[model samples]
Target: MSQGRTTEGVRDQRAELAEANHVLVDQGILDGFGHVSVRSAEDPDTFLLARNLAPGLVQPEDVQVFTLQGETDDPRKPYLERYIHSEIYRARPDVRAVVHSHSPAVIPFGVSTVPLRPILHMAGFLAPRVPVFEARDTLGSGSDLLVGTAASGAALAEVLGDAAVVLMRGHGFTSVATSIPEVVYRAVYTGVNARVQAEALRLGECTYLSDEEAAATVATNTPQIGRAWQYWRDRTA
Candidate 1:
């Protein structure tokens, strides 16, 4: 767990985070509003996320550090839903990275009764169930549905539990992993899985991977995530 928090190490992490922003944009997993963040290697109590800017355009200088309590002194305004990252990190010590996106293909499943399932081997993480967080249930009906406060964010994190991903009803979804690349991989594939599942439902009955099959596939696929990360990283480059 040594972060090598030398000046070079910090710079390298910033660059990787910036690259992740662009990579998510290239994969269409994030638009102008979504964001990605990584727990600070130098300070586990803090994390790195870009200031309020489009993911594709985030630069190293734009990346700002913030405490896990969601406090930051950066001159630029942070994303309103930054609590999504903060509270999740607070709740899950194993999670090192998080990606919150309004990915178009995945939105329908969040707002509808259709559950997003692992229709393909690449998305075995969706096997059990993608928990849906209904904001109204926690924040009241008139609320904005954004994880804008620490309390609301904590509620969402609770719903996420040990799951790798959680769907926010009428909003989007959040994906968490042990590394930035892995989280990006999960976020992108989750969107892909959603699209494929939607299409399968259109034709007729769709067969999903059973829990055992999904668990096996997930075990096998976990280590190969770097391949997709490299592909997406190169695309952004």
Candidate 2:
């Protein structure tokens, strides 16, 4: 459905997406539940994500195409939280990839008033403060925390706004970025930063990266993201 998009290019994109799944799982950013997606290279209005399979189990053939509205022609079941990727790509034109994960280290910040801040240069993308999305406000009370509907997903995107990551209350976190590697980088470092921040808090009052420092570090580190990606890819292999 993508005009002038080569079959080989699409195949390569599928392979890259599948590799992302393995990379995230290997980095502990994703488990049996989380997912990652890339905006279709040939079609901005669509994205590519693995089917209902676990991230560590996803292969190129398990990847499927999904519209920004989260529709897909494939009969196989999609992740119920696929809307997390669809609405993010829809809301943020600059974000070409999305990651939704129930990362353990970052879970407490989402539920408590404690804010998740950038404690390390690798996670400078989380500077300022991470916004937390409350599903109850959008879906009413007693709702499952999953972003299953378009409206709920859109609400989460609204909270995500211009930030690199948004935490879901009592759930997990969703990260967005300009590419798959970048989003994976953010997701992984965010968890690490959370763990470090919690330890610092346990000791005493903690210091965090200033906005200017965070910006500067992000500029310095982004180009080297490939190093981390390659290492994770090899580990997964």
Candidate 1 pairs with clashing backbones: none
What TM-score, to 2 decimals, does candidate 1 have? Answer: 0.96
Clashing pairs in 2: none
lDDT of each: 0.93, 0.91
Q: After superposing candidate 1, which stretches have Cα over 4 Å from the reference?
A: 1-5
Candidate 1 residue-wise lDDT, 1-237, digit = tens: 344546777898899999999999999999788999999888899999999999989999999999988889998999998999999999999999999999889999998888899999999998798899999989998998989999999999999999999999989999999999999989999999999999999999999999999999989999998898898899879
Clashes of each: 0, 0
| Cα RMSD, model 2 | 1.6
State residue 8's C-alpha deviation in candidate 1, in Å.
1.4
Lowest-sum lDDT 10-residue window in model 2: 1-10
* Candidate 2, residue 165: how far the Cα is off, in Å: 0.1
Scored by lDDT, model 1 comes in at 0.93
Error of 1 at 123 (Å): 0.2
- What lDDT score goes with residue 159 in model 1? 100
